[model samples]
Target: MTVTTSPLLAVRALTVRYGAAQALRDVTFDLAPNSALAVLGPNGAGKSTLARALSGLVPPVAGSFALDGRDLTGQSPDTIRRAGLVHLPEGRGVFPTLTVMENLRMATACDRRGRAAAVDRAFEIFPVLRERQRQAAGTLSGGEQQMLSLARALMVDPRLVIADELSLGLAPRMVDVVFESLRRARAAGVAVIMIEQFASRALDFADRCLVLQRGRIAWSGDADRAGPELLRRYLGEATAA
Candidate 1:
C-alpha cells in the first residue's frame, strides 16, 4: 500500500471555543499522506469541532495547524481549500436544488476549465451519479446524495480529505461503497482524516487511531494494536461486541 512516513498535516495544542464555551482543548496530532487516521469519540467529544477547525469553518482560539510547514492556523476557508485540503462535512454537504452534475460543477467552479474532466472523474467513482446527472440532488436517496458529496469533493483533487461521518445513515451496502471510495482515495496518496462515531468500522479501516474523551485525546496509537477491549475501555462498554 502507498504510504508516507513524513507528516502531511500537523496540529499542535489546538483549541476551539464558541463564545464562552470551549468546544475543544489542547488537541494535537499529525497525519501522513496515503494514510487514514480515524478520530473516534462519543458525541460532544469535539470530533466535529476538530473537523471544522481544520477546514477553517470554525476559528481556533489557540494552537496551530500546518500543512507542509505552511501555517494554516487562521487562513480563510477558501484559501485553505485552494491549498489542497478538502472537508467532506457531515449531513452530505450538497446543494439540494442543484442537479447531480451541477452540484459537482460547483466544486470545480474555481477552475472552470477543468469542470468537465472533474465531473467525469466523479462519475467514474459513482456511476449512479452519471445516470442521475440531470436529476435534482435533493430527489436522490440518502446514499446517492452522500455519493454525490464524495464525488464533488474529489473534483478538487485534494491532498488531504477530512471526511466527517462518511457513513452516518447509509445502509450497509451504501456504507461499503463510501468506504471503498475512501480506500481508493487513500491508495491514490490522499491523506484521510475520518471523524466517525462508529468506532468498530473506523478502527478497522484506519491505519492509526485517536480516541477523544471530553475534548481531550484519551488514547493514540496504531489501529492494529488497539484491540476491541482496548477501544471499549476508552469508548465505554456500549461499543460493539
Candidate 2:
C-alpha cells in the first residue's frame, strides 16, 4: 500500500495591486513540509508584496492561498498566524526597549501554558540568546538581534516562516550566522520562504528557486541550475555578493 502526503502550502494565481500599480500578477507556487524556497528579484519586483499578501497584511486583488490544505485566503492576519503561518518581515522585529527575555515573553502571550517550554526551546536553538537574556534587545549586535528575532518568532510554534530580506544590513560573518539559524529551522521541519539579496547564499540554502520580475514569476526551477546570467537578467543584479 502507498500513502500520500500533501503540500504544506498552496498558492494559485495570487494577484495584488497598490492603487493602479499591480504589485503581484498571478503568482503561484506550492511548498511542501520541510522545504525551502528562495525568492529572488530586483528592487520593486514585488517580493515583499507577495509575503504581505500571503500573511493577509494586504488583500489580494485576485487568486487564492492555503496553509496545510486549509483555505486561508481572505482570513485575518491574526487568524492566519494562529493557524501556523508566520511572517518575519525585513529588519530586526524586536522591542528595542525591552530585554531579550521580555521580548520572548511577549511572543507567548497567546499560550501562557507553553511559555516556559517555549523560552527553553528558544535558548536551546540559539544559545547566545540565553547568555544575553537579561540584556536590552537593542543592545545586542546585529547578528544577535536577528537571532533573538527568530527565537521570538518560533515561540508561536509556526509551521512555515516567510523571511523577508533577513540578511539586509549585516556584515558577511553575521549573514552566515543568520543563515545558519534558518538552516536549523529547516532541519526541524519548518518550511521557509526566503526573500534575499544575497542571491548566491539564498540559492545554496534553498532547493527550489523562484525569480520574480515586475510582480510576475519570471522563472521557477531547481536552485542549482538558476544561472548567473539569468539572475542578471531577471534578478537585475549580479548573482554573486
Candidate 3:
C-alpha cells in the first residue's frame, strides 16, 4: 500500500459537456509528485475529453483542478503548459514540415536556461532522433515521430506530464520504447497521468488505476491489484456489445 503524499495536482467534482451530451461527471482524483496513474476504459469513455480539459483546451462545466494550491480552472492551454503541466495529445504533435532538430528547437517557451542541455537530453532519450536530426519530421516512421513528440514534451522540463494514448497505432517495439521514456519521466520525479488504450501495459506501469465508464469513475485503486477479472467487469459489457 503506497500512500501518495504531497499531491501535486487535485481534480474535484469535475464535469464536462458537449452541448447536449455529458462527457464527464463529477470526476475527482489526486496525483502526487513522482507518481503515475493510468486512465483506462472503452472508446467514448471521456478519456480524451478529460485530457483536453486538464490541458485547458476545453472548459469544464463544473468542478475544479489545483496545482500546488493554485487553481487551474479556465486557464488557457499555453498558461497551463507554461506552468509546468505538459499535455502530450493523442497524435504525435511533431512539426511535420520541420526537421527533427528544428522541431526540438521550436518549443522554447519554458525555462530557457538549460535549452541546450535539454536538447541533448532529448537526443539521448531517442538516439534515432539524433541520427535523423536533419530529416524532415513527416518523413520519419510513426515510431520515430512519437519519439519526437515525447522528446518535445521533455524540453519543457514539466512537473507533471499528461500523456494521452501515447502508444496508439504504434508498432509493438515502438510502444515499448515510448513507455520506457515515460517510465524515465516518472523516475525523474515527475508526476504522470496516462490515458492508454492498452489496459495491461498501463496497469503494469501505473501505481494506481482509474477506470472511467460513461463519464464517471467506475473503479479506482492500486494498479497491480486490478487483474483481468476486474478490468473485464468494467470493460466487458462494452467489449461484448
Candidate 4:
C-alpha cells in the first residue's frame, strides 16, 4: 500500500472575525503540491478575508493553519514568507519609485540561493520585465504592474502562492497573460490558491474550486463539475443568455 503525502497547505476549521462581524466560519480546505485551487465568491463573501488569513496578513479568530506539517496558525507574515509561502496581494503592491528591475531584485534578495538564480527565473517568466527593466513600476500599465507583482512573488521560489483578485481591472487580453503566467507557476510545482471575482475565467485555469458565501464554504468540487448553478448560487445571480 502507498501513503500519499499530506497536502502542501491545510486549513482546519479556520475562522476569522473582524471586530464583531464574523468574516469566515469554520472554513477548511487543502491544497496539494503543484495544484491550483481557485476561491470563488460574490463580493462580501469573505474571499479576501480568507486569503488574508491564509497569508498571515490577518489573524484567525479560531481554528488552525499549517504548511507542510509545520504550524503557522499565528505566525507573522514575514515568518510565513520565509517558510516559502508567498502572497501576491490584491493591489499589486509594487514599489512606485523603484524600477521594475529593482522590484524584482528586492524580492530575489530574500531567497536562500544567491539572487542571481532567482533573477534569472523571474526574467524567464516575464521577459517584458527585462525589456522594461528601467521603467518605474508605477509608470507601467495596470497589466504590467500585475505581472511585476507575480514575478516578484516567483522570485521567492515559494511552495505555495496566494493571489488575491489576479484578474482585477485589466483588459481581457491582459487577463489571459496573467492566467498563463499562473499556469506556468503551477507547472513548476507551486500550489496556488487564487481569490477571484471572475468565475468563468477562474474556472478556466483552476483544477479545483471552492465557493464561499456569507463567510462559509457553499460548494467545493472539481472545476469541471462546477457548472452554472454552482456559480449562480455563489454569485446570487441567475444565468444570463
Candidate 5:
C-alpha cells in the first residue's frame, strides 16, 4: 500500500541487529516531504544502522518503511534509489582512482535524464567541481570529496536524501559549506535525513531532531525545544559526565 500524506518517508517498528546485538530496537519516525530531520546520537547509538536500514542497504529485522506511502521494506538499494530515496553513506564513498568528472559520470549514469544533465546539475551546485573536473577524486581535499559525494547523490534528483555523517572529519568552515549546500537542496524541495555528531550544528539545519540512545529513540521534538539539558540527558555521561 502507498501512503498519501505529508510524510515522504516513514518507518514503523523498525529493528536491526548484528548477530545477538540489536543495533536498533523498535525505531520509528516520519520525515515530511521537503523537510529536514537531524538524527542525533553518540557513538554506538545506532544512528548509522538506522540510516542503512532506511536506505535499503541493511535489511531490517522487523517493521516497515514507506516512501510517499509506497512500501519499500525489502527493496534493493538500487531499486530504492530509483524510487527517489537516495542514501549517501558515511565516509563519502567516491571512486578515489577516478577523476572528479568520472565520479560524477558514474553517479549520473543511473539518472533518468542521463549523464549530461546530471553533470550540469552537479556543477551548478559546486562550481569547484568543474574546476577540478580532471583531478583524481583521491587528490581532492576532504571537503571537495564531501561536495562531490553530495553532488553525486543529487544527480539522481532524489526526493529524499539520507546523509550519514556529512560533516565527519572536516574543518569547521568546510562543514558550513556542506551544510549550506544541504540547505540549498532543501530549498529545492528535497527532504533530508542527516546523521550528525555536532548537535548544535545539526540543529542549525534541522527542523526536527531525533536522538537515538542504544538503538532506540531517546528523544524526539522540535529542534528549538531540544536544549543542552535534554541533549546531555539523552547523550548521558559519555557527553556530559
Candidate 6:
C-alpha cells in the first residue's frame, strides 16, 4: 500500500498576459511540504513573471493556484503573504534607508506579541546582522543585505517562500551564504521555489526543476535530471550550468 500526501502548493494552467502579449501559458506544477523546486530558463523566459503571478503581484489571465488547499488565485499580495506564502523578490526586498535592526523590527509590525523574540531569532540565523544591527542597510555589503532580506521569512513565519534570483550579483563566497540561508528555511519545514539564472548550485540544491521557454513549461522533472545538456538545449549559452 502507498500513502499520498497532498501538495503544499498547486499551480494549474496558470496563464498571464500583458495587454495582448502572453507571458505565461498554462504553467503547472506541484510542490510538497518542506520541499524545494528550482525554476530555470534564459532571459525573458517569464521566470520572474511566474514568481510575481504566484505572489499576487501580477494578476493571471487564466488558471488557479492554491496553498494548503486554499485557492489563492487573484488574491492581493498582502493576502497571499499573510496566508504564509512569502515572495523574496530579486532585489532582496530590504528597506535601504533603515538600519539592519530597524528592518528586522519592521518585519514584526503586524503582531505586537513577542516581537523581541522574532528579532532575536533573526539575529540567531544571521549573527552578522546582529553584529551590525545598528548599521544602515544600504551601506552593508551585498551578502549582508541579502541576509537582512531573508530574515523577514523568520519574522513572518512563512510556509512557502518564493525566492527569485537569490544569487544575482554577489561574490562566490556570498553565494554559499545565500544558499545556506535557503537550507535553513527548508529545514524549518518551509517550501521554496527558487527562480535562478545561475543554474549549477541551485539545481543541486533543489529537489525538482521546472524549465520555461517563451513563457511556457518546456521541461519539468526531478532536479538531478536537469543538467548542462538540458540547459544548453533550452537556455543556450544564457544559463549554461
Q: Against the hidden reference, what TM-scores do the models get?
A: 0.93, 0.97, 0.93, 0.94, 0.93, 0.97
Query: Tens digit of lDDT per residue, candidate 6, span 24-136?
Result: 99999999999999998888999999999999999999999999999999999999999999999998688889999889888888886968989888888788898999999
The residue ranges of model 6 lying beyond 4 angstroms of the native Cα positions read none
Would you list the C-alpha lDDT of every candidate in the order shown?
A: 0.86, 0.91, 0.88, 0.86, 0.88, 0.90
Give the lowest summed-lDDT range of ten residues in model 5: 232-241
In model 4, which range of ten residues has the least summed lDDT?
Answer: 232-241
Off by over 4 Å in 1: 1-4
Write the residue-wise lDDT of candidate 4 on 1-241 in tens digits: 9989789888999999999999999998888888889898777989889888988989998999899989999899999998889988888779989999889888866554678888888889888888999999999988889889988887887999888987788888888888888887887778899887677778878889998889999899998888887677667663200
lDDT of 6 at 36: 94
* Shift in Å, residue 127, candidate 4: 1.3
Q: In lDDT terms, how accurate is model 6?
A: 0.90
Error of 3 at 99 (Å): 0.7
lDDT tens digits by residue: candidate 5, 1-241: 9966668888899999999999999988998889999898889999999889888888988999999988999889888988899888889789999999999899866454688988998898889999999999999888889889988888888999988988889998888888987887887789999888777878878999999999999889998888888888887655533
lDDT of 1 at 189: 70
How many steric overlaps are in each model, in order? 0, 0, 0, 0, 3, 0
lDDT value, residue 217 of candidate 1: 92
Query: Cα miss at 5, model 4 (Å)?
Result: 3.1
Lowest summed lDDT window (length 10), candidate 6: 232-241
lDDT of 2: 0.91
